[model samples]
Target chain A: MFFKFKNKKITNMISIVPNNIIKFEDEAGQYNFPIKRTLKMMDIMGYKEHRLFNDSVILSDVAVYGLNYMFENNIINKEDIDALLFVSNCTDHIIPPTSNIIQGKLGLKTDMICLDIMQACAGFVVGLLQSFMLLDSGSVNKVVLINGGTMKSRVSKKDRNSWPLIGESCSITVIENGGNNDVFASVYMDGVNSNALIIPAGGFRMPSSEETGKLQTLEDGNERALDHLTMEGVGVFNFVQTVVPEELKKLMDYAKIYDKDIFAYLFHQPNKFMLEKLADKMGMERSKMPSNVVENFGNSDSGTIPLVTTYNYGSLFEQEEKTVCFSGFGAGLTCASIIMNFGKLENCKLIEYGKNR
Target chain B: MREKILEILQDLRPELDFTESNDFIEDGYLDSFDMVALVSNLDKTFCISILGEDIIPENFANLEAIENIVKKYK
Candidate 1:
């Protein structure tokens, strides 16, 4: 199962594997509560803090820390990186793309290929797949894939169910072609559920405008403007509860692996309760499930899955563990998972990126 | 005033020991978000508005620095 690009040779291509994974969050940064507080503080400073989810300082902090940590550990040199793939719907600014900003900040070569993928929750996996394809095509040797987002403060405070739940995070994974025997990946999306969770304003379909801002309320009393994140909680829950498990089972079967063979199930950290419910439905032991960092960090959009992976790498990659599953589903009504067989954990270093800038 | 700020720091982030002159950001005690929240609480508690520019790293470096800002504004 290989994808070939026209006019591109696949031979002598390097295999992209997860060499090092790093997850970062601000030391004392809490989720929506702190975001709300920050907004209120901004209000006090006379800057109307509208579009709460537009730019996430916390997520950026985590990302910068992770990148710096990788640099510090010498996993991938700034000069050695051939391209950067940043997957996130939440960006630091509206223009110039977040990839450029990250490239500049990380002191990577200016000529390095920089691109941003605005996929919602399934971003990190999408990033991984994209980087893998790039590696397989011989287009790039070493690529840094960063998946993160700040969706906590984006949810409308008016919506009680989602307001207190969203978490923010940023994580980075360095994938270089290697000697591991990890199972390949598959990704799928449900366009029908796209509207189930979205920021109604601030995009090509519906650009931000005063008129659109006025039509802010949905039938469920959720805001439809860019001011906050709007989610149909029950709708999203039903979708995830139904789609994710089915997809995971399908992927596992396709890979000729059984549920019991899966060493650990790393899914998106939406919330503690929801994840446990999904784990229960899949007939997997709660102990096999990874810890939900969202309790403190909130739902960090694309960063959730990688953050979970980074946090649980120790237990999953024990002495000679061979198989683990990574899954993430969110915004785009998207779900993605891949079974990876980590051959040896001794060679890889788990870098702890601290937040400095 | 310094002791009061220390009390608040200890309350917010119990992980750190709030000494009289601890550099919050440098020592890994607090972050940008924490600093923002701390300033908000300080303003409400002491009835003062902290300017955005005033919320720089130097001003929020320690208990003494926070107390000075609060007292000056108060």
Candidate 2:
């Protein structure tokens, strides 16, 4: 779908990665021998370290930290937010929505709308879309879009595919109802490729059982129980390479914009290699597209777009606005792109979740 | 053309010896990123358009298979 949002604006965005840094080389040692070779492969793939939270920390804790930061720094008045939307594949409990927990923790007003969206990678764009929609109705003046909450506590220690790459993070984008700039977004989905990246068990479809919890080593050598995340890396990479560029081109063409008009192509940090290939296929300059987030902070999953945005343009957003694009593609075989005039993102800062709070 | 294809593969992922593995998919030598690079570079290098169907495991199985795909397009 194509959308041009005029009323809603992402005024500020702040992201936080936990204090704990999971270095690839140190962790790869546990898996043993092929460590050298695997490390080399990882190096080429543009992974160095991923941030993980201790057992004491939960997904909502990371999100609340960003929220508290925004409040303490006077970025936004809490009463102004009419809606609280939490988008993530992870939550504290399966029964009571994670948004409910966050709403209570943040002590939001009773009149506020709180919703939890169970989505992965394409979440940030979707979350923004939801916020824009809410604001377009005119009743809502502000919406707090929270992208994160997935915990890796369920990830098996033996699973290399997910452990080193998936970092724990949360990003808070404050969307408000005043902006003249146009926001163009395109979202595409193919549930046929849902299994490409999924946690096979633990859902209502196949409730987690003793059998489902059993960890087995597959032909690829990585071992993970059905309850943990399983990603068909190749399938996702191919999907992104094939679909992402096309979606990007369509969004750009519909807006009558080109590569030169964009200041930066902010993409989900699938990894360095895939981002490079996506940029190449789009016929865009590599410098215009940044992938340093994967190397520095690893894939923050659905939280990656805001995570990388804070990491790369944290300073830039504080200074002035520019024309930019954000794309998130991953699990659910989903792809989303947003081309918007970057307005002043007030008080853009990234902090270690545990370090401060 | 085959040498050029190998060169590009080697360039993309010089960490592992591309020639050593005949099984790119099963061997875990080349991943989807490598495959994307391979397709994009082969198109640019050989001046031949590689269809999406041509990006299967068989075409990228080994240096010989990659060479065959490139040669077919050439």
Candidate 3:
């Protein structure tokens, strides 16, 4: 006997208006290497007309900025948001939960449902899937999904590998109930090589403490407890090489679509090298692989994929009938892939708020 | 100096057919990060600290512009 999951129609599909994105440049006008400068950059970027701000180095700034941006654009009223989804690897406040902080900052409804998802890089994808499910369930009409990261704060400043490979960013995508067939399909990773990448400290198994803090080293030295990110590069490469292709194949199989059907493939902007390698392995063109933001933002944890989509929105979705594939992979050693179709909208307009001169 | 700048830019973006006349940023050949990194590497190679104000888009717009700036300091 075979069990089949019924395909539900997503009406009035969730799509971003004013898809052209404005980047939050660092105050010192530098790249990702300088963490202090980068944090300051967020504050400067926030002060601009854009809706988001980076008040503190904490990850919640992403949600705060998103809410602020939405309000500024008159996209949604504070009381109108029905559900809140906060996706991040770093949440400064442990007790009340990060989503609560976001709700407090945004002055959202007290009755609003809030939850925090700690899925590292794949957090955005998980949040997207969860928001879709919630919207499809008819329980919530509008959901705010925030994807933010501050991996730089967690890494030792002197650690070259982590220092160069990690960066910070936050973005929010608001999903609303619109009956449309545009949302399309999704695929997730099955349990295999779950521990390919991780942070060895500050979790339930190895809780953060003074002693653990002292033992942490920012370099590739003997001290393992500096609360830094750890990854088996080769191990992750192997798993990504194996599972991502399988996930892509499965998504294609389930959607009954071919490689040429999709307009663009927006995978997590891992790095230039990894992206090129993955493109080669997946039998996809380098152009189809939309981005590798490592040069500017480094690996922005969960924010990378969305950032790419936001940046490349014009070129990727120029055609009326277009399909874009979004895939994210990171710490749970998790991966989530979704294929979305885009259609012309009459109400959507691009907003350019920043100063060119 | 022009040839050297061209060499550095070529190294940064091996895909781009860069010349002394090509505008790095406006031509979509180099981004903000690439410009910063290029300045840092150039400063190291020539042993000069480039002020933030001096590193404008116009100066690094092409190989000739970068060479002119470098020659002024040298």
Best by TM-score: 2
lDDT of 2 by residue, A185-280 (tens): 999989998999888888889999999999897766678898888888768877987888888999999888789899998888877767876777
List model 2's recovered fraction of native interface contacts, to 2 decimals: 0.07
Ranking by lDDT: 2, 1, 3
> Which numbered prediction scores highest in lDDT against the true structure?
2
Candidate 1 displacement at residue A172 in angstroms? 0.9
lDDT (Cα, tens digit) per residue for candidate 3, span A46-106: 2111222133445575446545655766666787788888878678666778888888877
The positional error of residue B21 in candidate 1, measured at the CA in angstroms, is 61
- Candidate 2's DockQ is 0.20
Query: Residue by residue across A1-357, what tens digits does model 1's lDDT show?
Result: 212222211111111112222222222133233433334333222222111222424455556667776566554578888878879887776788788888887788876788888887788777877877777767688777777766654565454345444555566666667653545566778888788887877767777777755535554333435646777655666666777888888887777788778778777776654565577668778778864555434466777676665555644344455577777787788888877664343323333333222
Rank ordering of all candidates by TM-score, starting from the highest: 2, 3, 1
Model 3, residue A142: displacement in angstroms?
0.9
TM-score of 2: 0.89
Q: What TM-score would every model get versus the actual structure?
A: 0.64, 0.89, 0.66
Evaluated on chain B only, what is the TM-score of candidate 1?
0.88
Candidate 2 structure quality by residue, lDDT tens digits, B1-74: 66787788787767778778879888887666456557767877878766554677889999888888888867
| Interface RMSD for each of the candidates | 17.9, 5.4, 15.5
Q: How well does chain B match by TM-score in each candidate?
A: 0.88, 0.90, 0.88
